[model samples]
Target chain A: MFFFALIVKPLVLFILGLNKRGQNNLPVKGPAIIAANHNSHLDTLVLMSLFPIAKIHKIRPVAAADYFLRSGFMKWFSTYCIDIIPLDRKNRVNKKALFAECHKALDNGDILILFPEGSRGTPEQMSQLKKGVFHLVKDRDDTQVTPVVLRGLGRALPKGTALFVPFNCDVVIGQPVPAQEKADDFIKLLASRYDNLFQYCVTHQEPEQ
Target chain B: MFNIPQNSLYTMLLVLLFLCIGTITRLVLKAKFPQKDYTELRQRIQSWWWMVAILFFALVFSKTTAIILFALISYLALKEFLSIVPSRPADRRVIFWAYIIIPFQYYWAATSWYGMFIIFIPVYVFLFLPMRMVLVGETKGFIRSAGVLHWAIMLTVFCLSHIAYLLVLEDKNPQAGPIGLVLFLVIMTQLNDVSQYIWGKLFGKHKIIPKVSPNKTWEGFLGGLVTITILSGLVAPILTPLGFAYGLLAGLIISSSGFIGDVVISSVKRDLQIKDSGSLIPGHGGILDRMDSMMFTAPLFFHFLYYVKY
Candidate 1:
């Protein structure tokens, strides 16, 4: 928390600026899900920094265990520093156990940040979302799943790139999609919500020659 | 307490006076016309207070601080401009180079390297960026991308950096230092903007450029010109080394160029099909929206002063 407030927040705010809209749509109290498109590693940090520092303890990002836990230092950093709930992406045998931790976090009223696109894709392009977010929210009708679309972070600090060019990124938080009975229906609803929210980003103008 | 310059101190006081006057006028107007919403006016005034305070401290602190402040302004304006304009995916690396140019550009101003500072963007950056873009092997939309990227750098970084370069001027005027020169230019430019808006609202019948900016009128333009010219004639001698005649010329240059800058950005916004560039400032729109006139006025004012005094 000290590290985040001192370093991460300022770096995110000052260097890579976030022009956020619908910040009020983020539930004040949680038992909530913040599902956004994955573009860059900065997406997690940008979203976490959006909340007040006091609520930083209650917010947890669900990340891939295979990637985040590959190195000993990374495991420690992801677990302690970022406070991620590491999900086992390799083995489906422990799927129930993996979801148990997520259920437990929500049961404790912690906000879980999930990237439904599975992993970082092409910069500023949205890939087909996996059904993982749907499975998490399917039974938990009480939990509010907020769809957030992050633009320009991918361009600023996209995957396979260490260099961070300064760019104004947009964080558009939409009204929480109500839990549907079917997984396909839920994913469709979430996808449509993201489509609607993506429109609110900085309107792309044809470069005048 | 900080060994502030006498001229800078007076300018700060004058700015505070204007802020007070604006507040009192708004209060009186709210009282008289209770039905009308003064929310936008109130927001504008509040934002002005913040902008003025930040700018005042930056200019008065030190030359380095002032240069860095303007550099940040250039970064923000460029960010807003880039976010609005569409860029090719291949040009993303080229965009990184664009951001990198800002620091080097300001470094020239900080060191007062006039020879390199003048040609860095137009000559070096203009040639280098396209070559770098060509290396990406994506020729589709190549010309358009190069044009957009270069223009963004020129407008945001190259033009606005002139304000910072003002601080490093080798002038012999004891009464008007480099800081005073900056204060003079900024105050005159902003005052020109305010007076034009007020005049336009009061009696803006003849549309000057209705297609680009519907709100701009000839009456407003002339009213603002006369007001700024007279004010400059009075104020420039105190803040700058210019006499009354040169001051009037400075006023004429700022007012007309400031209008061109405003409409130029307006035309860009119109072409982009957006109302505001970004919602960085409450009433002013974006940093680009606020500094659009400065983009034009800064370079022109610097050259004018350079030719005359420097």
Candidate 2:
């Protein structure tokens, strides 16, 4: 495993030039919510490589249980390699535990990578964000919700697509939003932010800060 | 599979010894002084150690392989540079010329075509690129667009190829071939950067230019020179055919120039209102971050070798 990480990974990067952008927004310390719109499975790896191994160890990615946790190898790889948190989307009863786990991860000062879109959608349109993000922020006032927009992943490895189209991926990390408002108001605020984010992306733009 | 023979082990050991001197100096400086905020100088040092380690391998490889690797490095570094800087759609035609010139320049180096590689980009590509764009009959963004393309090609493609040019030596002394010259140039230039940064961090009492580069200090400048001189003295035999005093002089030239190079790029980023050139590398901020040292180091190092060794 160490050999794969230190040797194989860098070799691949050296060959491909592993072009990435907006990686500096990754916090060097403490807990934050990496809220991104989902596009493909490779999106997780793309985001993970944007930081060092030590920081990556502290990040817990929230993946849907019904899809990824079905197989034992998938479960082990996801859990061990990326610290994926399998949320059973089919069962509402399981959501309570999942939410608690996210909070627990945050409380431990670990980063929780969340897909607010809930599922993959058409590349032309982003998935309407589930209210889980709003609730998560509202519950933990201290936790920062960082908006991470990943482009070109759908092209790399699209959902329902078997072939991996080799392409450059860009990961943009926006400034963190402090949890200050109520759930409904926070949801509206976040939704509007998502709307602007998608607009910026579609326009192929950056915030001129 | 061009491998360096075991007889070259003594030379490799000398390179390692020089690396140790620089690394130890850095450690002492880091311990003596630490930054409260996340500054560019702090970040450069953090990644430079790893850069030195990679360079160790580059120096150890067989002469032919080392030349190819440096060419690839120049290519990758240039690719990262072009991606971030915005070029108008009109510049597309000229960019095609720019990409092809990358490999051609390296081919000149590989075949020991010294005269052509030196003049190819500045003389031929420089004239040809603008002429091609002018023929396209696009008046829109004529100056601003052409200027960006020119800057990218000059800095990324032209200046960087100087590292490859180091592979071709006028004197074919097998004792210290072109590979040794290349190694010497890289080590001396990089050592200057690492040492100056360490000195500045440890005893950087007064900011030289607060607005342009806040972390730079007079104390650091003097300290870095002493450190680099000592390093040049140690690593002279393995990487270069230079005597200790000559190596010290060469190291000083590379370090001072590299410092100026870093400041120039920093000013560009500030003007652009961006923290980094572009976040292409983790821990390391941008293409510019990795290339900041190289921009000045390459041209300066090449000429120093050209004058001394050639």
DockQ of each: 0.46, 0.09
- Candidate 2, residues B1-310, lDDT tens digits: the string is 4354332445556656765675676667767776534355445555655665666566566545666676666666555555445444445456556767878888888788878988988888878888999997777777876777778677877777787776666534456566666666665666677788888988899877789888888888788878777777767655666678777877777777778878887887676655665455556776567677777878876787668766
TM-score of chain A of 1: 0.94
lDDT of 2 by residue, A1-209 (tens): 35337853674365323544345666666577888878778667666666676566777888898878779998788777777777777766565675877778778988878888888776424766787887777756677887777764554456776654333345667667557566666666666766665432311221121
In model 2, state the lDDT of residue A38. Answer: 82
In candidate 2, stretches whose alpha carbon ends up further than 4 angstroms from where it belongs are: A1-147, A150-169, A173-188, A191-209, B1-8, B14-54, B135-138, B170-173, B229-238, B278-282
**Where does candidate 1 stray beyond 4 Å?**
A92-95, A203-209, B24-39
User: Against the hidden true structure, what lDDT does model 2 obtain?
Assistant: 0.67
Task: Quote model 2's TM-score.
Answer: 0.61
Worst 10 residues of 2 chain B by lDDT: B1-10
- Clash pairs, candidate 1, are none
For residues A1-209, write the lDDT of model 1, one tens digit per residue: 99789989999888877777899999888899999999899999999999999999999999999999999999899989999998988767775786988999999999999999999977777789888888887777779899999988877787898877777788999998987888889889989999999887773622333
